[model samples]
Target: MKFATALLLIISYIAVASAHMAMLWPTPRGGFGTKQYNGRIHAFIGYKDNVWKVRFPCGGYAPGPITKMKAGQTINVRFYASGMRASDIKKQPVLTKSTKQFHQARHGGGMCEFSLSYDGGKTFHLIGRYTNTCPDAYFKWPVKIPSNVPSCTHDKCLFVWSWTANILPQYYMNCADIRLEGSKDGKLPSQSIQIVDFKNRKMNVKELGDGIKHRASTGPTKKEISGNLSGNIPKALKKA
Candidate 1:
């Protein structure tokens, strides 16, 4: 009887902890969900109670193998479900039919942004943004790699997915290791970003949300945050 009770307690915890949304596509190396995806899968990939770990890709978990693709390709992201209901997960690992739908508010909503990285994680640039609009699950975000992007001189680049919640100060982040081959005569992008931390102010949350509100863009952003970043752009990007 005691062993059964202890097992019950453990399941209750996973249900509460996995409330944040998980990114499904351009498919992060890690993939999504605790046990719902195909092949080998892991637990939810959100910041949740561990909000401070936003800086670490995949919540500080070592990333998965590289996802290979070419330049100017359209990237798509999928989520298990949209905002789910509470009763959805009361059964714990028994996984009621609602487990996939358990990602409701507290499941964290608000904004999502996609970016690209070259030079072995030294610097990254903005590639796409989705604001005030991701549904509970399976959001297909098809973003095309700019025709002017440089090829993987080395073989690949990092694809990053960042989500900020509206109900709390949590930020969810994940990255897919990608091998990108861009056009030979590449033109650099206008704007790029390098997010390294998080804040708690209401203003900060709105600011973070607002930053990604604009439609996907190219070239330096109209709104720039000044920093002394030392990472340099490639010759093709510099000319852009």
Candidate 2:
């Protein structure tokens, strides 16, 4: 009798412990819940009086709030997620093509003016104007491009590009960001592009162009560029 009573007590203790443990559910509405983000998948189970939360390595909470499970409901959570880098937040192509036309104009104080286009061939916008002063002669104005623009869709969408500016005399350069929005149907393609960073240092347009072209390539021709600007820009530009 003592042995049977001890066994019953042990089982009761296990049941109590299991009751305290949180349970995960696949769906919040009925059973446990599931969520996914950044290529990571998570399964959630809820227990009465138990609360759960998950965080991304890049420093952000999952899309939803903590889930609470009622008594007797088991929460199940699943997600196909990956780590997102700070640089990934800014990866998008700089430009689809050399849409800007070269022009010379005069600004106040006899400053030379230049313009370029964010669109492939739609419109031309002013880049900057500079005075002929020796110190000011080599100064380049910084331009921030919009976050969205349209580009041909092959497989995965590409967005964002960045480079440092080279101060030059008589010659001026410009950078732009283009952002694209998708159609309401969720089938139509949209794009966004922009110049996220600009500095007085000389920019390697040729290299930047080549990097974009490589990314633009399909199949075996596709190549990856070094630096966070290229790596994260495309992901940031992707729709949620």
Compare the candidates by lDDT and give the number of the best one: 1
The sequence of per-residue lDDT tens digits that candidate 1 reaches over residues 121-237 is 456666665544432342345555666788764533688776654445555666677778788787556666534235432333421222222121121222210111112222111
Off by over 4 Å in 1: 1-13, 16-18, 33-55, 81-102, 106-108, 153-156, 194-204, 207-240
Cα lDDT tens digits, model 2, 1-240, are 653553354334333322111111111111112232211112111111233222111012222322222211211121101111122212321222324311111111112222223333233433222222111111112222222222222312211111111221112211112222422333211232222122342332211111221111111111111111122212221211
Query: Which one wins on TM-score?
Result: 1
* TM-scores of the candidates in the order shown: 0.58, 0.15
Model 2's alpha-carbon lDDT is: 0.21
lDDT of each: 0.46, 0.21
